[model samples]
Target chain A: MSEDKLLEVKNLRISFPTTRDRIEVVKGISFDLGREKLGIVGESGSGKSLTGRSILKLIRAPGQVTADKLSFKNIDLLAQNEKQMRNIRGTKISMIMQDPKFSLNPVMTIGAQISESLNAHNKLSKSEVNQRVIDMLNDVKINDPERVVKLYPHEVSGGMGQRIMIAMMLIPQPDLLIADEPTSSLDVSVQAQVLNVIDDLISKKGMGLILISHDLVLTSRYCDRILVMKSGEIVEECKASELANAKHPYTRGLLAAIPSLNETRDELPTLNRLQKEPI
Target chain B: MNAIELNELDIFYGDTQITDNISFDIKQGESFALVGESGSGKSTILKAIMGLAPKWNGSIKVNNVARSHGIDYDFAAQCQMVFQDPYGSLHPRKTVDATLSEPLTIHRISDQNERIEQVMQSVGLDLSFRFRYPHQLSGGQRQRVVIARALILEPKILLLDEPTSALDVSVQAEILNLFKKLRKERGLTYLMVTHNLPVVSFLCDRLAVIKAGKLVEVTGVEQLRQGNFKHAYTQELYAASGGVIS
Candidate 1:
């Protein structure tokens, strides 16, 4: 582990127990992150989401998570008990899931949820907590936060629901945020706006961010560095700007798959599964 | 006659209006797109045309035949829809062969085997994938199966609702190429609803931009190609989609 590394995960492995067989998803993966934004790119079932969830001990029974070294801001995450993990889950490190409908409690008011997160971690007065919730909502660019606070989860649209989710996650003022396909559910136009909101907050707060997505172009544009994962291991790691000229075949395949605005080919090149030879 | 026409269309879910005074027409064999953000009522227009949202005040004439708010067998035989998510649209318990043949069975079309095989090949799906379940196939394969199902009826007008948004980039490219080839071979009319401006430029001949349930502008693909979006809302949408003004 280095001095500037905010998160240092080494040789992490995760597996699930089935009725007749044990399936391993994450296989001895290692990665080190600084205070800047890092993105993990992989297709679904590639163990990308599991890796993010394992960081916060969100992998429950029937699924086992193990690592040689897992540390966050000089704290050993693996050694922490359930009590310590709870205190750290929302207060120090937080995650925003893909779908708001599933991530948010459908019955709870937006304000009540944010306040509940605050109450679990902070010892502030009710007024202080309310004011902080309002401030956080405003920070995420929610106009009329007061009115929005009363709305239930189902009442808000997808984009607004994502914004509210962000506000609730940030209200605790966590040092690290793990977002798993946060903008995939959003419309293309709204995707940029919501990402801009997250990007703005990450810069303002100087928090370490981990963005997990399958979009190669989007990851290149939004992240500082990109990690291309295949079969639970990193195939290539490069600076975001350097991705257009990536070296690895897997990364190249991913980039070539994106349909360019100035497309000339009758058919875009698709990656042959046989070509993915044990990277 | 235009392939599709809508004049003075107004849609309501109960008493609340969703889309207002919308009008557009698509020429025969032309790929037309409707672009808008979520909650901007893009899909509502498609639903209204498909007669899913029955509560509406307008005329939806497809292939010169006026459509009422109900299931029309003639319309089903002429037009069909391909949904966005292959996983959700496809039946988990049903095999790929069953999914493709179901529509033909419903329409009571003869020569089911030949029609299914032809459509399966047209969408570039191999014959081996016909018997596999949706869970056994990849995302790209599932989407291809969905496209094959849509084309099994040999519908002249295809209504695609964000078909590629649910797929991976590489998979999306493959699907896009399939769409291009299918359109070329069949001379099909496409009324695609997508928020992706790049996709519209890649596939559509003309586009209708909607905002807050109103038709803002109807522009040619050439304008989009030259980055010449006239309306402010269209330009804003183009900008938001990562298209920089040069």
Candidate 2:
């Protein structure tokens, strides 16, 4: 393993026990994360979300997560007990979910929720925590942090809500941040803004980021390295700048399927599922 | 003859105005698009045409025939809608056959089985999956079924509200191809509402950009393909979608 690696995983597998058999979702995927941006691109049911959730042991009962090696900063994650895992969850590592509408606490003020995360991870005075909350909100580019602190989640627009979610997750200053489809729900203009905030904070804080999304162009544009997943496995890994020259057929197919800005084809080329190899 | 004509349209939900003074003309067999972000009243225009938006004052015509405010049976036969979110638009308990057959039953059309099969084939859905429920199909398959349901009535004009937005990129390509084929084969007119500029460039002939309930500009798809949008908001949207401004 590299010395600068923030997180490492080897042969990670996640499964759920059904009545008849155990169905595996993440089928033996492995990767190492440095203090740089990494992107995981896959469609629905490809186990990208499952792989992210497994890092923090967020998978619930009936869903079993097993791995040959899963570690953070040379610490074995599998050996940690529930209490120890809780300590590392937000303080050392955190996750930002896809949609803010469901992730944010609707009943609580945005400021209170952000402060709660800070208080839970560290011991700080009320004023200090409040100050950090406002500062974090401002870091995410929210206008008028003082006024936004009192507003509830429902009062903010979708883009603002997502930024607030980012602020809440980022306030703890985790070593690594896993964001799942962070801006998929926002408008195009707002999506660009939210992504810029995430990009800026990731660079400024020197934090490792795992950006999980299905949009190929978006992931390629934002990440340093890209992992293309299909049927719960990584089909291709490449430098983000060379995604257009990817060698894997799946990656090429996906890129071709998306209608470009200067699309001239009478019909976009679709993936030939019938010819797809068995998982 | 124009396939669809909206003149000085005013749409409202209760007392709140959704859109005002909206006017456009889609010629016969033309594929027109309404491009805007969410809450920009693009979908409301489709709803108003479908009689879903009741509080609307406008003269809407289809094939040179004026549309009344109520649900006109004659108009219903000529126009149909394919909604966004194939997951939510479909009924969980209903089979694909049942869903497709309902429109025929409503219109009291005979030869239901034959029509259903034909429409299913037209949308490129397998006949073997006709009895499957919504949960049994993939996102792309579910969207095909939804398209089949819309086409079962043999409508002349299809009102599509973000038809491919909910599907994956590969699936979206297949669905878009299917739509193109259907329109060409059936000589159908399309009024599509979507925020995806790339999709508009692919599938539409002309597009009208809507912003906050107002039409900003109407231009040819060639302009969008060339990133030649004149309106500032349209340029912003194009740039936001990662289009290189030439």
Candidate 3:
């Protein structure tokens, strides 16, 4: 294994039990990640989010995650206990969920929540924590952080709420970020701003990013490499720049489905859902 | 003839005015779009037209008939709406057959069986899905069912609120194509509210950019494709949607 590799997964599989049998959601898949942005793009039940969650051992009971080898910085992730996993989570490999409105604690003030994350991993004075929280908020481009820190989640707009979530995730200064549809809930204009902030921070801190989204064009724009999953397996993997010329039929169909801004086609091409979207 | 017209429409909610001096006209069979952020009162305009938001002061005319300040059954049959979230819009307990039949039964339309079957076929759902509940359907299927419900009334106009935003890219493509086919076949006028510029470019002829309940810019899809917006906000929104004009 190369020293540059931040994460290494070799034939990882995740399954959940049903009444009849266990259904494997994430079939055996393998990949490696350095301190670079990697995008996992797929549909709703494609198991992309499950793959990301399994890395941090976020999958609960009746759900089984197994792998030939899964390591982060040469640390055996599969062997980590719940307590050890708790320490790894939010500090070493933090995750930012899809909706900021649901992820955030509504009763707690923004500053308190972010500060709580910071305090969990590190020991700092209250004044220093406040200063750090304000700085992190500013890093996410929140104007007048002092006032925002005092306000609750409901008081902030959707864009602001998402930025707060980003700030909280980054405050721990994790080695990697698993952003699952981070900007999906925000408006188009706000989406760009939020992604730009994440990009800026990732570059500055030299952290690995695993962006899980259903948007092909968007994931390509941010990631160095792209992995396209269908159902439980990875159908295609290629460089972000080569996505338009993807080899897999599913990828080609997805690329063709998105209506362009200057769409001239009378009918947008659609994948046959009944035939499993391969062709 | 104008299919729908809104003149100086001002909507209020318990002393709080939402939209101010909003006015537009949709020609017969023309698909129009209202594009903006979440709180811009885009959906509220549709609600006001559907009589969901009653506290409004404006002239709302459909097919040259001025709208009164109450429930209009004739208007209901004339203009139907498709909501944003397919998951929430559908009742979990109700089967597709029950859901589709309710509107027809309420309007006292005869030939119920044929109408229901034909509407389901139009939306591309086969007969097997009629008896199935919403939980058994995918997001795309549920959206199609919603569209089927809207079309079962045989309304002249459709008020679509981000109809495909919640579905997958491929499913969205299918739905957009379905909308295109339906409009061409039925000559239906659509008033769609969406923030996705590319979708607006595909399905709508003209679009109005709304910001904080105010109409900032009204431009054709041609101009939007060419990135020829006069307003700064429209340009910003276009840029944000990742303008891939290829």
Candidate 4:
């Protein structure tokens, strides 16, 4: 691993055991991350989420993850035991899921939940923890952190819930953040707000980010580098600025398929699956 | 005559008003859209038109005939609705063929087998999928089935409530294209509710922007393309979508 490389993955494969056969959803994908934004763009069932989850070893049994080299900061991730993995999960690399409705604990206060993330890794005093929770909430741009901290998860709106989720994930100041479709559930304006907050925090902390989303344009806009994934493989990799000129037919097809603000096409050109060649 | 008209519509759910005095019209064979954020009462407008929101106070006319506050088989034959969440809209246990045939049976239309086959083909679903249950089909395929069920009755108008929001972008494009082709071939009137602004530019002629149970702005799609919105909220929404015109 290079000195600047935060994480490195090679020949990563994730599989699930079914009744009759074993299905490999993520088949031999490889990538490296520095303190920069990397995006994995794919549609449903393209194994983008599985790859993100496999990084933290979040996938449970009946499912298996294998890799030739899975190292974070030169430490072997695949070699870590379960108890050891727990310390690395949130403190070193945290993940934010798609929906805040299901991710946040319904019964706990927002302050308590944020506090829990910090208290799990560090032994902080009561006042320090409370002040830190409020500060984190404010960092995510939540209004009136004092009042919001006392409210339950159900009381906050979807956007606020998502920001709260971000606050919880980032309070530990992880080296890498894996946000899997973080803003998909939010409205457009709120989506922009949430992404901006995340972007700001990542830059301020100088952390690596893996943004997993099905939206091509969104990924290109937010990430420094974009990886177009299809059927568990990286079909193309390029700078985000060069996504419009992506060489792969699949990438070109996806780029053309989205309706732009000034849409003039009589019909969007659908992706031709028969033309998809292995990369 | 207008294909659909709503005059001074006010919808309520047990004394809590969901939509204010909203009114709009869709001419014959016109494509119209209602766009807003979630819970802004865009979907409620579709529901009121479909008679699912029974507490509406106002007139709803389909093809110049006023609708009653109950299920009307005649109205059902002329107008049908395709809901959001294709996964939940279809019956989990029913095969695609069975789902398509039920609408025909409800309308007492004969020659059910032929109609089912034609509609399935029209929506671009393969014949092999006709026997598959909802779980057996993909999201796009299931949506195609839902659209097929809505079209099997030969309705002149369709109420699409966020039809493509649940699918992936490529799948969304395919479905949107399918909708365009269907509307052109059948000369259908559409009242689509969505929060996606670009979709309106691609698929509709005119759009009504709603906010907090009130009508914000009703403008032509050309204005939307130009980013020329009259209301401040509409401009806010346009900006929220990145305000890109190219």
- Model 1 TM-score is 0.95
Sliding window of 10 residues with minimal summed lDDT for model 3 chain B: B237-246
Q: Write the per-residue lDDT of candidate 1 for residues B1-246, one digit (tens) a residue.
A: 799999999999999999989999999999999998887788998888888999989799998889989777778878889898998999999998899889888888889888888887778777777788999888888888888888888889999999999887777878887898899999999999998887887888889999999999999887886678779988888777767766
The candidate maximizing lDDT is: 3
Per-residue lDDT of candidate 2, residues B1-246 (tens digit) = 899999989999989999989999999999999998888999999998998887888788888988777677888889999999999999999999999999899999999999988988888887888899999889999999999998988999999999988888999999999999999999999999998889998899999999999999999999998999889999999999999889
Each model: TM-score of chain B? Answer: 0.97, 0.98, 0.98, 0.98
lDDT of each: 0.88, 0.92, 0.93, 0.92
Query: Candidate 3 on A11-120: residue-level lDDT in tens?
Result: 99999999989999999999999999999999999999999999999899989999999999999999999999989999999999999889999999999999999898
Question: What residue runs in model 4 are displaced by over 4 Å at the alpha carbon?
Answer: A273-279, B244-246
Q: Which pairs clash (backbone N, Cα, C closer than 3 Å) in model 2?
A: none
Clashing pairs in 3: none
Best by DockQ: 3
Which residue pairs in candidate 1 collide?
Answer: none
**Candidate 1, residue B123: lDDT:** 80
lDDT of 2 at A266: 96
What is each candidate's DockQ, to 2 decimals? 0.51, 0.61, 0.65, 0.57
TM-score of chain A of 2: 0.96
Off by over 4 Å in 1: A18-21, A273-279
Best by TM-score: 3
